[model samples]
Target: MATATTHGARDHARAQEGNRADAMPVVPASAWPDPPCAAGHLVWAETVAGGGSTHRVLARGTELRLTDLTGDACAHLLLFAADRPWERLNTADTVKVQWNAYLGEHRLLLSGQGRVLASVTADTSGRHDALCGTSTLVRNSRRYGDGSPQSGSPAGRELFKLAAAKNGLSARDLPPSLSFFQGVTVREDGTLEFTGSVGPGGSVTLRAEQDVTVLLANVPHPLDPRTAYVSGPLEVLAWRAAPTAPGDPLWEATPEGRRAFLNTAGFLASRGIA
Candidate 1:
């Protein structure tokens, strides 16, 4: 249902479907793949101690591989269209399309436009964590505090705020979001609290249907400090991703917020946000 396929096969099929005679070369395992910057191109990235890149998947058959390089690491992933940042990879729609929680090698990252962005073709470590989250504070702390180069740009929170505003979401509705690598737990009162790292080297893949702007930043896992620290480090890795057509499903919930996400997207598109 999610339209997932192996790297080689997917690319070949997309090439045939698009009737393109010329395509770019593939990524070598030893090198970091770079994504395309075309109007409809889509790409994925995995962040490590040192910044890295991914080879751009131009065709439907293109496949992406993200190596933890380390044992267990988390990646905060976000998606946007290369031509239209407003028309993005809505997480809520993705969850709905899959009709399940906890994405892994078994599941494919889907887009609101009904296409595969990436797929987890292989993984050495089976300890991929779901429920991780990302935000501006987390990115800043990890990058600047972790001895990375100084960032003259805005932080995650700021960027998110800007994106939200551009998407027509009020500041009140836009909160810090978590991506791959954060952890969470339901409480007795049915409350969701943040946890820590899930594990290390937990990689995930994303196949691109169209061009997307993927932002992977390190951040604190979703958890509430007040709760008991029963679980160990919580980590999540996202391997698959894709773009959706107009009026597509994203995220995996029946909550009002998720429904509104779709409505908001449509509204944005009406206003030319997409």
Candidate 2:
């Protein structure tokens, strides 16, 4: 038989224990380190504004990190082999090879020829969109009633087209892109829904497996249902990384990863890059 006073004390003690447990330090998923390059030596860095785009050529063994400076940022990215421009990233192959519909960390960006183009080495925003493509000028104009680059509301396709022209590529060369920091969910009826999951300071690091030309558009996803067209800026950082070792995590992520890496390695070796 316990008294009311004893019962109250026990309840208080349990509450305190729960409070202490809640106070324990918990690390966020996005608390990843910067690229493994020299602390002060950055190859390139820039802040891409919403509805804007940028492109750059990255050498093999180099890593590029994209940080969401503001929450709700989306970066649509396309990768092409620098040497062989025809060999570009294939989103279908990338997802099919890994047997995963969702892209995340440790996934290799596979080229059209089943070769590794780049690898997602580190990712703070785990949910990236592979199915929903970028928004287009016509689509945006129809949706928002204003999709002019001059009006400062260019669509993702418009930005991608401009970026492609800078690299001497044409609209026909533009393929499907991966939308980083944007998440999509599939309903029971096979309908896709856009979901925001990234926060400020969340970042994703991609390690190039070959000399790759990257085209990125900081724009709202096509399925983004925000009425006001809220797209945030993205911080880009590029740094040189060490050569991939035999025990690299990307290579060991899956059987498909190993195969794609070997294909890429063989291609490079044939080109006298051994």
lDDT of each: 0.42, 0.81
TM-score of each: 0.46, 0.84
Model 2: residues with Cα > 4 Å off, grouped in runs = 1-36
What is the lDDT, from 0 to 100, of the residue 257 in candidate 2? 83
Q: Which residue runs of candidate 1 sit more than 4 Å off their true CA positions? A: 1-47, 50-59, 69-72, 113-116, 120-133, 137-155, 158-178, 193-195, 222-274
Task: Give the number of the best model, judged by TM-score.
Answer: 2
Clashes (candidate 1) = 70
C-alpha positional error of residue 224 in candidate 1 after TM-score superposition, expressed in Å? 7.9
Candidate 1 root-mean-square deviation in Å:
14.5
